[model samples]
Target chain A: SAVISQKPSRDICQRGTSLTIQCQVDSQVTMMFWYRQQPGQSLTLIATANQGSEATYESGFVIDKFPISRPNLTFSTLTVSNMSPEDSSIYLCSVVSFGEAFFGQGTRLTVV
Target chain B: AQTVTQSQPEMSVQEAETVTLSCTYDTSESDYYLFWYKQPPSRQMILVIRQEAYKQQNATENRFSVNFQKAAKSFSLKISDSQLGDAAMYFCAYGGSGSARQLTFGSGTQLTVLP
Candidate 1:
């Protein structure tokens, strides 16, 4: 089992500003996943952060828009750069432990 | 790419009754996993149950069970003896076999347990 802690459970940000969400896992993992859940929508994969290498983003997401940093095996951060109202959503980090996927308490970001 | 589809947008069940949420997926991978997750008002996603494609027998966890029809690509979750605490948004997800097993989620179904 994995216990994940996410900071700033919810935050209101001004448009054009950036907010970085942090995720700390209980144990070290080889790869971590980042997801975005827009209002009234299902979760979508933003990127996969692998320690010692760059993060791999999904088709609609790009590095510039959502830069991720995996400084170590147990920690990762996702930054939503130049936020917009459309970017207001819940951000969740996930990892696989014992073949089960565990998620952090999502960070709800509201961009004004 | 794998896609999960939950046809039911909303469902209600009387307390102590049963409810089933529908889910269908499209994936070419023969080896994969199916999951049902419950997200409450707190936005914490809790894994309700899981089923493996290789398992022919259905997967059950206390009041939660799945009717997994691999050939039909359908996996439905049945919640028995529903309680008020069961009210939440239920999401069906598909995770193919891999290291990370990146998940593809369905739209979601809001389950309301009526007293």
Candidate 2:
């Protein structure tokens, strides 16, 4: 198991503003992923952040809306751009290694 | 495409009693992994238990145990001596070995532990 942490646990941002959530892991990992959990809904995968390359977004998501950066193995960031009221949800980062994936203390973003 | 399902939207149980959360998944592959995660009001997702499809014996951890019915594609979690802390949203997840290690989570079941 890996200890994962996210910065700015909760934030209130105005519509049209962008917020970048940071995820830090205790050790190097091969794959990092981003997920969104809307109020009273199940989680949906946003993208897979791979170090040194662009992320692979899920079917309903796009890179322009959720830009991701995985500069290294132990850290990654997901920025929700041009936020809107519909974008209000908890953003989580996950890491997978040795067939096990762990989640961070999600970032609760409230867009007003 | 793989999908996980938690049919029960919410469940309630009295403290010190036992409760079971049901989960079923659809998959074409033979080998995979199943997991149950607990999310409290604090909203932190915590791993409760896991089971590997290839393993015939069920997996158990403390008060948490799983009934893995491979042929039925069912993975249910049983909490013994349920505590108030067990009140939360529980999510069922599925992941396969190899490069396809991404987890597919089910709609959560909110468990309410009453005193």
Predicted structure 2: clash tally? 0
- iRMSD of prediction 2: 1.5
Per-candidate TM-score against the hidden true structure: 0.98, 0.98
- The lowest-lDDT stretch of 10 consecutive residues in candidate 1 chain B is B95-104
Q: Number of clashing residue pairs in every model?
A: 0, 0
Q: Give stretches of model 2 more than 4 Å off.
A: none
Every model's DockQ, to 2 decimals? 0.69, 0.68
The candidate that wins on DockQ is 1
Query: Candidate 1, residues B11-107: lDDT per residue as tens digits?
Result: 9999999999999999999999899999998999999999989999999999999999999999999999999999999999998776766788999
Q: Model 2 misses residue B37 by how many Å?
A: 0.4
| Candidate 1 residue lDDT tens string, A4-41 | 99987999999999999999999999989999999888
Give the number of colliding residue pairs in candidate 1: 0
TM-score of chain B of each: 0.98, 0.97
RMSD of 2: 0.9
Error of 2 at B56 (Å): 0.6
